[model samples]
Target chain A: MDKNINVLIVDDYRTMLRIIRNLLKQLDFNNVDEATDGQEALAKLRAGNFGLVISDWNMAPMTGLDLLKEVRADARLKNLPFIMITAESKTENVVAAKQAGVSNYIVKPFNAETLKEKIEKVMVHA
Target chain B: MPDGAQAGPDEDRIEAAVRAVLVSMSGDLTAKEAALLAELEALGRTIARAKAEIAQLSVDDITGAHIPSATDELDAIVDHTAQATNEILDACETLEKLEAEVPPAAAEALQGAVTRIYEACSFQDITGQRISKVVSALKAIESRVEAAVANASGRPAPAPAAAAPVAPKTEGQELANGPQLPGGGTSQEEIDRLLASFD
Candidate 1:
C-alpha cells in the first residue's frame, strides 16, 4: 500500500471529516480530500483519481449505500477500494455494504489503530 | 234494551276502560319518540362540531411552526457539537506536532493522549447521526399530522414538501438506519464475524 495514495473522506459532519483526515495524517497518508455529502463525493470520485473512499453511511440526498451502488455499477470506479466508516452497525447495514463490494467497515468511536488496520487491510487487498 | 240484544253495563264499562288505556299508551310512545329524535339530533351536531374544531386546529402550528422549530434545534445541536469537536481536534493536532520535539517519554505520553482525544471526538459523528435520525423522525411525524389535518378538513393531503428527504427505493436502501443506542446495536466483533461469513 502506497502511503501517498490519495484518500477521499465523505461525511456530512465537519468534525468527523477533520478527525479522519488527522488520523490519516498520523498513518502517514498525507494526500486527503473531504466531501460533505455523497453527491459531492461522487462528483469528486468521478473527476479525480481517488485511490480510496471512506464514507459515512447516513447522509442526505444520496446516502453512502447509494453512492456505493453507483460506484459498483460504474465500470471505471468499480474496482476502487471503498471502506464504510459509520455508526450504522446494524447487521443489515454490514451485509448491504458487503454486498455492495465494500472492502472494509469501521464502527464509530473507533480509535486510530482500528482505522489504520482497516485501511491497511483494504489497501492490501485492493 | 232492544229485543234480542243483550248489552250489559259491565261489558260496556270494560270496553271503555280498555279504550282509555290504549289511548294513554299511544300518547306516551309518541312523546318518547320525540325525545329520542331530539337526543339523536343533538349527538349529530356534537360530532360535527368536534370535527370542525379538529380541522381548525392550526395545521400551520404543528406541521409548520413546531416541527421545524424542533428540527432546527437539533440541527443547531449538531452544529455546536461539531464546532466543539473541531476545537478539540485542533488542540490534539497541535499537541501531536509538538510531541516530536519533546523527550521520548513525554512524546510517548503526548501521543497517547492525542490518540484518546481523537477517539473521544468520534462522539460528534455518533451524536450527529443520532440527531439526523431525530430530524427524520420529526419529518415523519410532520407528514402524519399533515395527512390527519387534510383528512379532517375533507381535503386530499398535499404532496410532500420538495425538500423532504427522498424515500428509500430499495430494501438495501431502507436498511441504512443510523447509529443505534447503547445495547441496541451489533458490536464490532460481530460485524467482523458477519463479514467473514461473506467471504
Candidate 2:
C-alpha cells in the first residue's frame, strides 16, 4: 500500500516542492504529482484519482486549512488522507485542524525521515 | 457548728431576696455588655467591608478607563514610529538607487562625447584627403604648363619632374607659398555636395 500510493504534493515554493517530491520518491512512492496552491491542487484532485495529499499550510488564494475543510466536506474526497505541513505551532490551530478532520500534522523544516514517519503514521491509521 | 447552723424563715427569705437581686443585676449588666460589644464588632466589620468594596470598585474603574487609553496611546506611538521608520527607509532606498543610477548616466554621456570627437576626427581625415588630392592635381597642371612653354621655345625640355614632392617646409616658406591648394582645389560646394551624398 505504501509503495503503490498516489501522492499529490502541494506547495508554492518550487524548491520545497521538488524536495518533497524527491523525498516521497525515495520512500518508494513513485506515483506523484505537484500543484502550487490549494485551488490548483483541488482541480488536479478532482481531475484525477489521488490516494493521499501532502500540503503546505500558507499559500495564496486558498490556504491548506481551507483545503482540508473542503476535502473533508466533499462526499467523494472525505475518506482521502490529508497531511498538513506548516511552520505554525499554535495549539488552537492544531485543534481546529483536528476538528476539520485532518489525517495528521507535521511542522515545517522537516527532513525526509520526519516525512516518512508522518506518512507511515497516517497511512497506518488510514 | 450549732451557731452557724441556727437559721429561720425570715433569714432564709432575706438571703434568697439578696441572691435574686444580685443575679438579676449581673444578668442585666452582662446582657447589655454583650449586646453593645456585638453591635460594635458588627459595625467595625461593616465599615471594613465597605472600605474594601470602595477600594475594589475604584481599582476596577481606573483600570477599565485608564488601561485602554494607555494601550491606545502606546499603539498609536508604535504605529507612528513604524510609519516614520518606513518613510526613512523608503527615502534611503531612493537615495541609494539615485546614487547607483548617476555614475552610469555620467559614463554614458562621457562615452557619447568621446564618440563625437572620434567622428569629428574622421571627418577631418576625409577633408585632409580631399585637399591633398586637389594639391597633387594642381602640381601636375603646373608641371604640364612649364613643359609646354619649354617645348615651344625649341630648347631641350627641362628635366622631367617626378611625382609631386611632399617636403616639410619652414613657417616662412609656408607663408610665402600662400595656402598651397591641393591640385589647385575643387570648390567648397562640390566637397559639401560629396559629403551630403554620403549622408
Candidate 3:
C-alpha cells in the first residue's frame, strides 16, 4: 500500500479535519486535502484524482450521501473508494451507504487505528 | 269542547320547550369552544417558551430560532480546541522526530510534556461529541415546538422533524439518528455485524 496516496477528507468541522489529518500523518499519509461539505467536495473531486474519500455523512447544502450518489453517477469518479464517517450508525444508514456503493463505514468517536484499519480494508481490497 | 283555548296552551308549551333546548345546546357548544381555545392558548404559550430556549441555543438577527447555526457555534468551539490540540501534537511529533539530537533528560521531559498535551487534546474529541448531544436535544425540542406552532397556526413548520440531525428534510433517512452521548449510539461491532448481515 502506498502510504502517500492522495486522500480527500470532507467534513464541516475544522477540528475534525485537523484530527483526521493528524491521524493520517501518524499513519504516514501526508498527502491530504479537505472540503467543508459535499458540494465543496464535489468541486475538489472533479478537480483532482483522489485515491480515496473520507467524508462525514451529515452536512449542509449537500451531504455525504449526496456526494456518494453523485460520485457513483459520474463516469470518472464512479469507482473511487469512498468511506463515510458519521454518528448515524443505524442499519438504514449503513444500508443506504452500501447501496450507494460506499466502500466502508466508520462510526464517530473512532480512534486513529480504527480509521486506519477501515481505510486499509477498503484500499487494499478495492 | 274549548278547542281554541286548548290549542293555544299546547302551542305555547311546544314553543317554550324548543327555546329551552336551543339555549342548552348553545351553552354546551360555547363551553366546548372555550375549553378548546384555552387548550390552544396553553399550547401556544408552551411553544413560545420553547422557542425562547431555541433562540438561546442560536438565533438570527430577528431573534428567530436557527438551531443549525446555533449548534454550529458549539461545534466550532470543539473544532477550534481540536485544531489547537493538533498544533500541539504537531509540535510533539516534531520534537519526537528530533529526539535523537536532544539530551536524554531533556528528551524525556519533552516527551512527557507532549504526552500530557496529546492526552489533553483527547478531551476535545469528547467535548465535541458532547456538544453534538446538546445540539441534538435542542433540535428535538425545536422540532416539537415548531410542530406545535404549525398545528396551531395551520401552517407547516419548515421541516419540523429536521430538528433531528444526520438527514435532511426531503427524503430524510428512515433510520439515521443524531449524535449520541457517552454510552449511547450503536457500537462499531454492531455496525459491522449489521453491514455483514446484508451479505
* Chain B TM-score of candidate number 1: 0.69
Query: Which has the better TM-score: candidate 1, or candidate 2?
Result: 1
Best by lDDT: 1
What does the lDDT come to for candidate 1? 0.81
Q: Top DockQ: which candidate number?
A: 1
Q: 2 or 3: which has the higher lDDT?
A: 3
Instruction: Write one digit per residue (lDDT tens) for candidate 2, span A60-96.
Output: 5666777887888888999899988654344445556
Higher DockQ: candidate 1 or 3? 1
Please report, in order, the local distance difference test score of every candidate based on alpha carbons: 0.81, 0.57, 0.71
In model 2, what lDDT does residue A23 have? 57
Q: How well does each candidate superpose onto the true structure, as a TM-score?
A: 0.76, 0.39, 0.61
Which tens-of-lDDT digit does each residue in B73-122 have in candidate 3?
88788768777776876787787687668999987686566544544555
Q: Order of all candidates by lDDT, from best down to worst? A: 1, 3, 2
Per-residue lDDT over A1-126 for candidate 1, one digit per residue giving the tens place of the 0 to 100 score: 898889999998888888888888878899999998788999999999989999988787788988898899989999999999888888888888999888888888788888888998889988
For candidate 1, give fnat to 2 decimals.
Answer: 0.73
Per-candidate chain B TM: 0.69, 0.29, 0.49
Candidate 3 local lDDT, A8-123, one digit each (tens) = 99987676777677677667788999999999999999999789999988776777888899999999999898999887766678888888888888987676667878988888
Worst 10 residues of 1 chain B by lDDT: B1-10
